[model samples]
Target: MLSTLAMSVPADSNWINFDVPALIQNFWSATFDGLTFGAIYALVALGYTLVYGVLNLINFAHSEVFIVGCYGVFFTLSFLGFGPSVPNLDFWSIVLNLVLALVVAMVASALTAFVVERVAYKPLRKRNAPRLVFLITAIGVSFSIQYLIFLWRGPNPEVALTMFRPTPIFDVFGTIIDSQQLVIVLAAVVMMVFTDQFISRSRTGRGIRAVAQDPDTATLMGVNKERIIITTFIIGGLLAGAAALFYVMRIPSGVQYSGGFVLGVKAFAAAVLGGIGNVRGALLGGLLLGLIGNYGQILLGSSQWTDVVAFVVLVLVLLVRPEGILGTSLGRSKA
Candidate 1:
């Protein structure tokens, strides 16, 4: 069976290109692409970081929440009568469609996060369950949500309808920077800044921080732990939903049921790389990871090795700094 399976798998010929000069020549373009992808990873990582900061539990099913956002984009675009065959929209139409799709995706993802919290995590929390139980429950919820989507949407990848075809907005050192790339980076940065400010300055943000610091003390101080938890989940979901929209814009063919698995793992790695509970760490780690993976792929000569390269980077980083680049010591608030 192993022999047969090996024979059935096709070989990747483009796995090793050792053209250093060519790699150097395309460095700018690669960096642009990396930053764009890194921003998406950062957004997803924020979800992981935020939830972990508060609950100290890794919500493995957060990926499913992201997948829901992707589907939300798809259904919204379809409802708007946009598809592969449709012509690109006019300027105002593009803006309207994007706004609508973003709203829908955020709402869908937020709802999914709330439901997951209520159904999966809340019960365990109330019971004062062991950490192992929470981990197992998280894995179970992740699988259940993934397969449920598979049952509903089937195993096929959904193609996102392009509302606006990418047009080159500028050139950087002979590399053309397109509209989609600009949008992704700008949107991610804006969202990150907003989130950081909200957490650091807003009333609700203070509640979240207090809970992360000490749930018992926070409760005593009149912070509604349940409400704060729900808020954190909702904020994370909102970011994940926006990231999903950007992701499909970058890789339109990435809307399958299992799509979240690898991306989710990478995002988690990014969270850990940046200091899992640190908000800014997620952003920094994501961008760095993106650049590393892109450069590694170029150096290795094939996109097939991207995942391997990313994991290797993660392992190396962990070995050097187990707390992550900006991660604080355990039990300390870093967000």
Candidate 2:
């Protein structure tokens, strides 16, 4: 009976589509674009890494931090006479516009992160709340921000004026590298490097490492625990804000009430993929996840199934290396 049932099954099943030929054909373009999106993921992942490093909290609300920064970019551009139509501004003017927008996004995200810490997480810390309680609060704060944005913006996406048409920057093999991809990838790398430097080289960073290694002992060493935690969140927010700017630049129509949900999940996965507790690991994870996800989408034959492919790859990686590719290393020694 079992043999008969197996023999009756269709040889050509459409349920799980795997278009390997298509993936191979579009491999170059997909890899390039995947890197673009992956940069955004890595930027957001830093927030998760930082908070988890210091407080041992996941900070699910960090996604909202990113979306809030996107909104900041939208409003800043709108104020500078940018709309849905093509801009008549000169090239230098466009540069200025983006620079201003970046500042606003950074400030907005940083402040939001600071407030989340003060209002949402600090009280819990004062009470010496359980880790589970901190996790729940992070989720709650995330929802609260999401709904507030929903109430204010409704459900539609906010499309912005095109920042500038992406020009060809250079070519890599057969791939045409565009301005947008260049900016996103380059900016993300620069920021990540700067963050790594700060964490490893600066005095304040030393204090942060101390806290991550042993919070009680760090406090005893005359390091201000609250200040270090606040600084960590600020840095995370700054990176998230930068990610938002690049995100809106790459996909202008992505700005919405809950735009950060899926991106946030991907970033978190990237963090875990690189090693949840490690800064450098998050960066590696983000880039690899991006490439893998792009290849997966092409192979699977649809953008909708991208997440399915991404998570499957993540599971595979976990099975092979539970500590992640780079393992969990913050600025300090391995936890």
What's the TM-score of every candidate structure?
Answer: 0.93, 0.94
lDDT by residue for model 1 (24-133), tens: 87799989999999999999999999999899989898899998999898888888988876455678987898899899999999999999999999999999999999
Q: What ranges in model 1 sit over 4 Å off?
A: 1-17, 329-335
> Which ten-residue region of model 2 has the weakest summed lDDT?
1-10
Q: Ten residues in a row with the worst lDDT in model 1?
A: 1-10
Model 2, 1-335: lDDT tens digits are: 44334434436765565666677778889999999989999999999998998888999999999999999999999889887776888999999999999999999999999999999999999999999999999999999999999999999998765888899988877789899999999999999999988888789988889898899998999999999999999999999999999999988898998899989999999999998878898898999899889998777666777888889999999999998888775745442
Q: Would you list the clashing residue pairs of candidate 1? A: 17-301
Error of 1 at 100 (Å): 0.3
Local distance difference test, per candidate?
0.87, 0.90
Model 2: residues with Cα > 4 Å off, grouped in runs: 1-12, 331-335
Q: Which candidate is the best by lDDT?
A: 2
Error of 1 at 220 (Å): 1.5
